[model samples]
Structure formats: C-alpha cells, structure tokens
Target: MTIQFYLNGELRREDAVSPTTTVLDYLRVSAGKTGTKEGCAEGDCGACTIVVVRKNGDDEPLYEAVNSCLLILPQLDGANVVTVEGLARDGHFDPVQTAMVESDGTQCGFCTPGFIMALFALRQGNEKITDGTIHDALAGNLCRCTGYRPIVQAAHQACQDATKDLYGELSPLIPGEGYEHNHQKFFAPQNLSQLAEMRTDYPKAMILAGGTDLGLLFSKDRDPLEAIIYTSSVAELGEIEETKDYLEIGAAVTYTRILPYFERLYPSFATLITRIGSRQIRNVGTIGGNIGTASPIGDTLPCLIALDAMLTLYSKTGSRELPLEDFFIEYRKTDLKPGEFIKSIRIPKLKNKQKFRAYKISKRYDQDISSVIGAYRIEIDGLRVKDIRIAFGGMAEIPKRAVACEGAILDKEWVEDTALKAGLAVTTDFKPLSDHRASKDYRLCVAANLFIRLYRDLTDAEDLMEVVAA
Candidate 1:
C-alpha cells in the first residue's frame, strides 16, 4: 500500500518507505529536498519547518506550519506540503522570500528555509497582522547569527496581506483509510466504528493524533512502530460540539483549531495555550494527547483540571465519561484500559461571577516546558470567595488539585490576606521534587506566588500578566 500526497504541487506516492519515516528524512533523503535543514532532530528548532495545506470540514483551505521532523509519512497522506524549495514560482521568488532577502533576515542561511516557510504559512492566514502575531508566528523558528529585527521587519512587510493564490486551486482529497509496507500497518480510520474495530483488533497499536509526542519515538529514538492507528482522519474525533453548558472537543482536534473557542471562553487559558509550544507545535498538537501523556509538567493538564474537564473514553464495548483530574493515576500513568482511547473532552462553561485564570511559569516565554503551572477557577459574591478550584503542575507526580489551598480560601474574603493564606496552604497540598527545571523550594514558592498573581488578575489589576524584556 502506498501513501499519497502532493509534494510541491506534484503528486507523490510511496510504498517502500516505512510508515514511521519522518517527513524530514523523506524530504531530504528520498525527495532530495535539502532546503529544509535538520538543525535539531527534535521540534524545538524551526529548521525543519514546512507548510501543510489541508481542508477543514467546511472545505476551506487551512495553511499550517508544522515541524517536519515530528511528522510521519502517513500523516501527510492526503495533504499538500510546501517546502522552502516550492516558494519560488516561474523563476520568481515568493513575496516572503523577497522580503527576507530585502530585509536581510538570513545570516548563515541554515534556518532561513524554516523561517520562510513559517512566514509563508503566516502570509496565508487571515488573522490581522500585528507585532504579537508576527512574534508568535516566528517563535517556532530560531535564528542565531541574524537578530530578529530584520525578521520582524520582513514579517511586517510581507505578512500584512493574506495570500490565497498559492495552493488555493488545489482540491482536497478523500483521506486514505490505511496503508501497509513490509508488515508495518498504518490505519487511518474515517469514522468511530472503524476506529473501535481497529482498536479492538490491534490493541497495542500506537494511537496517533497530532503525533507531536509519539513522533519523537520515530524521529529521535528510531523506534520501529509495528502498527499505528492515526486518529486525526476520523471525522467524529475531529468535531467541536458546543452546547449551552459545555464545549465538547474531539480528542483529535488540534490546538490551532480550538484556540478561537478558548479565546472567547477562557482568554487566560488561550494565552497559556500559545505558550504550550510554538505555532508549529500547536498546529498539530492536541489537548487529548496532552492528557494521555500525563506528564507532571503538561501545561494543559492543570488548566483542564481546574476547569473541571470531562473525558469520553471509547472502546469496543462502549464509551465511558471520566473526570479529567481522575484519569491520571500516577507519574506518566493514566487510567486508560486496554483497547480504550480518548474520544472527547467536555469543558463546562463558566457561570455567573465566575472567573478563570491560568499562568505558565517557564524560563522562556515560548517552546519551553513549564517549571510550574497554576490554574484557578474562582467564583465570588461581593468580595467573598463563593467557590474555587485550584490545580497545579510541575509540583508533584501528577497534575493535582490543591484541596488544601481551596479550603484555605473558600468562604473567605477575596483579599490579599486571604490569597496569602491560600498560598501558605500550598505546602500542605504538595511536596514538589527538585529537578533540572527548578528546585523543590523554588517551585513551592512560585506556586504560592501564583495565587497572588491570580488575586491581582481577578481584581482587575492593570498588569494582569508579567512583562518581560525581549
């Protein structure tokens, strides 16, 4: 079986390549498109950035910049991929490339291709161009020799207008169901029934959503995946069902697809999502994958727990709903049974006088794991704490709620002193470990200080978020 995709506007089919082969290796080794460099095999560096154009449910073209290093060959089975080499058309450079040349955005040119591709996707977006958007778009791509001044200038000059000419005429494809090469099976089911059947048959298959996490095994570790069940192609798993009480997000929904809802419902959580990784990571990363990973420092876990999210786990037998907080059993362990997979996450909407705030404490603003993440959902009645839920990450073996902290502030006056008392109660709730990212004491201190920050934030302080010098 062959995996089919449009590479640089040319149809390409591969049957000999391993399904686990990363797009980076496939492009450089097989396709001989070396313009996309491999500075870091991991997704941290933007050197392997590439533009993937796919259609959404509405049949609208979605131009996304993703890390080629972290994407497998089957993941691009029905999409149009644009590399840096594809930017020039008819002997003329794309506007972004011209802008980069005129603005002197390249130094050694190793990372230039990634930057151009990132900007190429940005230029295709309809979002209003601003300094913040420009920085967010370029955050995934890093350049050492050339400073960001020219890069910023180039973004300002080029991305001010959205372009639809490139790949606009390309039609969407009916997603391929599955592929196999050399006994390695890759299943891409289009519906829930098919997924359930496949899950029951191949219970040990690596379930891939965005593949940002499991792709590491294929890219850096060179692990051989005997079987993979790709979930993104499943229509039901990609739906976003909204009700008056809650928003039900399919487990396969990408972070980029769900950011708009978060921006409207939970702005602070949206801000935190932007920092989960760079735009490249978010373009393909899913919150369900975040919860499944069950990392102590998973940025979305604490926020989802504080918001009281619920999960819909599906299996051949049936589906069961579980609280998001209770799903994590221990460090890097979850309550998922064999043949069971996450179907959707349902997050309840905020009620009257309710406010939510989440803060991610990391060394860098973007593309860094959290040192400590604190999330709060508090309800107030005339300066009195009516109800509150607090959850923290990077503080223990699992993303846990601070019951002691909540008890400290519940039914008390929402004041500085009350916030401080809750902060002190953090000691009773968790005993964080000392790791390379931060010390135990430092984490405790920061976790405590986040309460003060949350207090100030809910009280309508001008400086809601801390400002750092760039």
Candidate 2:
C-alpha cells in the first residue's frame, strides 16, 4: 500500500517506505528535501517545523505549523504538506523569507527555515500582530545566536501586507486511504464503527491521535510500532459539540482547535492549556491524548480532574462512561480495557457563583513541562466555602485530587488560617518522588502554596497569572 499526499501542490505517492520513518528523515533522506532541519528529533526544538495545509469543514483551507520530527510518514496520508522548500515560487522569496532577509533574522542559518515556516503560519492567520502573539508562535523555534529581536522585526515586516500565497489558495484535498508496509500497518478510519472494529482486530495496536506523545516512541525511543490506528481521521472522534450540560470534546480534537471555546468558557483553564505546550505542540496535541497517556505530570490532567470531568471509552463490545478521576488506576495505567480507546471527554461548563483557577509552577516560563500543576474549582457563598475541588499533577504517581485537603477546607470560611490548614493537609496526599524536575519536598511545598494562591486568586481580583515587574 502507498501513502498519498500533496507536496507543494504536487501529488506524492510514497510506497516501500518504513511506517516508523519520521517525516524529518523522509524529507532529508528519501525525498532529498533537506530544507526542514532536524535539531531535536524529540519535537522540542522547532528546527523541523513544517506547514500542513488542509481543508476545514467550511471548505476553507487551514495551514498549521507542525514539528516534522514528531510526524510519522503515515500521518501525512491524504494531507497537504509544505516545508521550507515549498515556500518559494518562481525564484522569489515568500514575504516571510523576504522579511527575514531584510531584518537579519538568520545568523547561524540552521534554525532559519523553522522560524520562517512558523512565521508563515502566523502571517497567513487572521490574528492581531503583537509581540506576544509573535513570541508565542516562535516559542518552539529556538535560535541561540539571534536574540530574536530581528526575527520579531521580520514577522512585523511580513505582516505589513496581508499574506496571500499559493498555500491554502486551492481547495482542500481528502486524506489518503490506509496502508501497510513490512508488517507495519497504519490505519486511518473515518467513522467510529471502523475505528472500533480496527481496534478489535489489532488489540495491541497503538492508538495515535495528535501524536504529540506517541510520536516520541518512534522519534526518540525508536519503537517501530507494528500497527497504528490513527484517530485523527475519525470524523466522530474529532467533533466538538457544545450542549446545555457539558462541552463534548472528541478524542482527536487538537488543543489548538479547542482553545477558542475554552478561552471563552473557561479562561483560567484555557490559560493553563496554553502552558501545556508551545504553539507548535498544541497544533497537533489533543486533550484526549493527554488523558489517554494517563501521565502523572500531564498538564491538563490536574485541570480535568479538578473539573470533575468524565471520560467516554469506546470498544468493539460497547461504550462506557467513567469519571476522569477513576480512570487512573496507578502510575501510567488506566482502566481502559483491551480494544478500548478514549472516545471523548465531557467537561461541565462553569455556572453562576462558580469560580475556577489553575496554577502551574515550572522551571522555565515557556515550552517547559510543569514541576507542579494545581487546578482548583470552588463555589463560594458570602464568606463561607460551599464546595471545592482541588487536583495536582507532578505531585504524585497520578494526577490526583487533594481529597484530605479538600475535606479540611470544605465549608470553612475563606481565610488565611483556613488556607494554611488546607495547605498543611496536603501531606496526606501522595508522596511525590524526587527527580530532575523537583525534589519531593519542593513538590509538597508547592502543592501547599498553590492552595493559597488559588484562594487568593478566587477571593480577590489579584491575578495569580501576572508576573510582578521589577
């Protein structure tokens, strides 16, 4: 079987290629298109950034920046992909490239392609051009030599005119059919029944949604996944529905796509989601994938657990719904049965008198994993605490609620003394292990402090997200 896609408006059919081959390798070795550089095969460094242009429901083309290093050859099946090489036309530099040249954006020249591609996506978007937006777009692309002043100037230069290009100018093309090569199979199922049947057939097959985490297996760990059932192609799993009760986010919905609704409905939670990854990561990372991985330090887990979210698991046998909290059985383990995969997550919308806030303490400000992610949702009546839910990631073997601490503060008056007691009660929760991220003591200490921050953030108008200027 062959994988089909459009590269620079030209149709590409790839056969006899290894299923586990990263797009970075395919671009450099097989295709001889080396414009997309590979600095960190782990997708941290955006040196391998590329643009994927596809059609949305409205028949309008959407161009998104993705890390080629983290992309498997099969993920591009039936999609349109553009690398740095595709940006030029008739020997003329794209606006982004022209701007970069004028502003001296390239110094070492290795990471320039990635920066240009990232900026290209920004230029094509209908966003307000600001330093913050530009910075967020380029956060994943790191250039040590250039202080980023020139690159930002280049972004400004490119956006001075509305970006019009060959990219997204044509109608979107449909994705390719499934393929199998050398005992490895890549399945792209369009409907839930097809997905469920595929899972039933390939019990141990890897379920890949956004490939943010699963892509690391092949990129970094070199795991040649024998069979992969990609959920991103499943229309049902990719749907996002809003109801009177909850926000039903399909398992395949990327963080970038769901962010706008989150921003409108859950601002604090949206802020935390922004911190989950850089714009590049979020472009392909899904919240359902986050829940499926069941990682203890998952950025969204703390928020989901605190929100009292529910997971809908689908299998060939049937479908079941369970509390997100109950989904985690232990470290890196979930209650999901064989042939079962996460279908969707339903998060209840905040209502009148309900307040929610999430705090993340990390070693760095941007694109770094959390040392501790604390999410809190509380309901208050006057000075009395009516109801509260608290959850933390990176403070235990699983993203868990501080049940004892919640008990300590429940129905208590919102005060410093009350917060102190609840903070101290955090010890009753799981004992976090010491690792490179933080020490056990540090985790516990921050866990206690977050409750205080959450209280202050909820009671007063003081922004916990703000950094005090010097």
TM-score of each: 0.97, 0.96
Which lDDT value does model 2 have at 26? Answer: 92
lDDT of 2 by residue, 26-102 (tens): 99998898888989888788999998876666867778899998989988887888889988888999999999999
**Model 1 weakest lDDT span, ten residues long:** 461-470
Q: Estimate, for each residue in 1-470, the C-alpha lDDT of model 1 and write its tens digit.
A: 67888888998988899999999999999999999999988899899999999776677777899999999999999789999888888898888988988998865667889989998899987888888999999999887665888988998888765655666335465568999988899999999999999999998898999988988999999988899999998989999999999999999999999999999999999999999889999999999899879999999999999999999999989999999999999999999998899999999999988899999999998899999999999999997899899999999999999999999999998877898999999999999999999999999999999988888777754333332211
Candidate 1 wrongly placed segments (more than 4 Å): 161-163, 460-470
| Model 2: per-residue Cα lDDT at residue 151 | 94
* Steric clash pairs (candidate 2): 78-175, 78-176
User: Positional deviation of 329 in candidate 2, in angstroms?
Assistant: 0.5
In model 2, where do residues sit more than 4 Å from their true spots?
168-172, 461-470
Model 2 TM-score? 0.96
